[model samples]
Target: DAGVTQSPTHLIKTRGQQVTLRCSPKSGHDTVSWYQQALGQGPQFIFQYYEEEERQRGNFPDRFSGHQFPNYSSELNVNALLLGDSALYLCASSFWQGYQPQHFGDGTRLSIL
Candidate 1:
């Protein structure tokens, strides 16, 4: 039983570029959520996907987007990246219920230069 997995554990990009990060959810999980964690700060919710549709969103800008595939894997995309976007991008998954605790993957550390 594998837990959630995220690829390209680290990334380097320049301003105005776009980047995509991938995630594979744990077994028996159906919902995927993206979060951004700045240095020394807690995670900030970006968005969530369930059943191939976006089910909830946070206060992030439209440049932040995500997709949930039929197999429960997910991807997070950021466009027009800014230097401030440098942070850890995390992917979390849980059962479709509202109160379930989410399981997180080792995040992708994104650095914008």
Candidate 2:
């Protein structure tokens, strides 16, 4: 089965600009969660989407937003990006939900210039 997928394995952007990353959840998953992973650090949850609505949010600011499509795909949008926003954007999904172990894609490596 097709697993989670992300686009633009690497990207470069400047400060104050905006960037949008894409993700496709694993087969049979209904929930999508976005996360940010800094160099050498664990993934930090940004938010989660279920039923086309954001179900949970993390410590990130409002500038970080996301959406989940009916096909179980997801997208992460970061506006007014900053140098600090440079990190790996990851999308993970679970089969049953309720905090189950999620499978991760390699991620989109975003770099702020």
Candidate 3:
């Protein structure tokens, strides 16, 4: 009965530092996707992972990477972070190639200080 969950509800970091965000899939979900949302903007797809492999990616640069564990949990990593990177990072979980509805976590608010 668990839903999607993300860690470090809030985070503060400096430009050029690396950060890792984590997520746990909702019950019965097998795919995990990451998104970034800036103030006043809609979420932008970052990438998605399934079966321990990246099945799809957005226009984001290589600096954005992720991993899907055997248990369906996921981790998103941002390297050489920049001020523009400060935003709400969201994780969503879905099943069957995203044909089913996705459940999202509350999101992690990241601030570049």
Candidate 4:
């Protein structure tokens, strides 16, 4: 079965450009959650989408937002990116709520250049 997938495995951008990262959920799964992991840090929840609605959000600012399509794929959009925003964008898929241990992809390594 196809597992969770992310695009542009690595990216380098300036300090003030908008970026969009993509993800496709695992086979037969319906939930997607986005996380930001800074260098040497644990993953921080950005937001989660289920049933085409944003079910939960983290402490991030408005610049961080996401959308989940009916097909169970998702995208993370970041506007006016900052140098500190550079991190590994991880996409995880679960069968349902946060109670389950999620399966994660290697993630897209975003670097602010």
Candidate 5:
């Protein structure tokens, strides 16, 4: 079975630019979570989508937003990008039920030039 998959394995953008990262969850998964991992830092939760609605979000500012499709695929959008926004954006998926383990993708490496 395939795990989560992300597109545009690598990307580059300039400050004030906008970018969108895509993700396709593993089979049988219904929830998707987005995270941002900076160099030498742990993954920081960005937000989660379930039932096509944003269920939760982290401390990230409004510049970060996302969407979940009925097929359980997802997209993470970052607007007005900043140098600090350069990081590995991860996509994780799992059952929406309690205590299910999440499976993550290799992530998209975003560089702000």
Candidate 6:
């Protein structure tokens, strides 16, 4: 089966612009998590979704939002983007069972100007 997939591998946005990145989880996965990775830094957890609801969130501000559909695909939406928001957005998916390891997609590279 195909692994997780992310869209628009690269993007450029001006400050204050809004952007949405998409992801599709691997087959049979029921949970999706989003992360932001700045240059040279490890991925920082943003949020997680299961059963179409957000189950957890990190320290990110409200400007960062997301949704998961019944099909297990997901989207990460960022509003009023800032230069600091430029980073690689990663999506990982796994079963909702306890301690399941996540499978990640090739991240979307977002650049703010």
lDDT of each: 0.95, 0.91, 0.95, 0.93, 0.98, 0.98
Query: Candidate 6: where are CA atoms >4 Å away?
Result: none
Show model 4 residue runs off by greater than 4 Å: none
Question: Which residue pairs in candidate 4 have backbone atoms (N, alpha carbon, C) closer than 3 angstroms, thus clashing?
Answer: none
- Candidate 4 lDDT over 9-98, as tens digits, reads 999999889999999999988999999999999999999999989999999999998999999999999999899999999999998945
Per-residue lDDT tens digits for candidate 5, residues 31-95, read: 99999999999999999999999999999999999999999999999999999999999999999
Candidate 2 vs. true structure, TM-score: 0.95
Model 5 global lDDT (CA atoms, 0 to 1): 0.98
Clashing pairs in 2: none
Residue 73 lDDT, candidate 6, scale 0-100: 99
* Per-residue lDDT of model 1, residues 1-113, tens digit only: 99999999999999999999999998999999999999999999999999999999999999998888999999999999999999999999999977999999999999999
> Which tens-of-lDDT digit does each residue in 27-67 have in candidate 2?
98988898999999999999998888998999999999988
Q: Give the alpha carbon lDDT tens digit for every residue of 1-102 in model 3.
A: 989999999999999999999999998899999999999999999999999999999999999999999999999999999999999999999995536877
Off-target runs (Cα >4 Å) in candidate 1 are none
The TM-scores of all predictions, comma-separated, are 0.98, 0.95, 0.97, 0.95, 0.99, 0.99
Q: In angstroms, how far off is 100's CA in candidate 5?
A: 0.9
State in Å the error of residue 81, model 2.
Answer: 0.6
List model 6 lDDT by residue over 1-113, tens digit each: 99999999999999999999999999999999999999999999999999999999999999999999989999999999999999999999999999999999999999999
The CA lDDT at 5 in model 4 is 95
- Regions of model 3 farther than 4 Å from truth: none
Rate residue 30 of model 6 by lDDT: 97
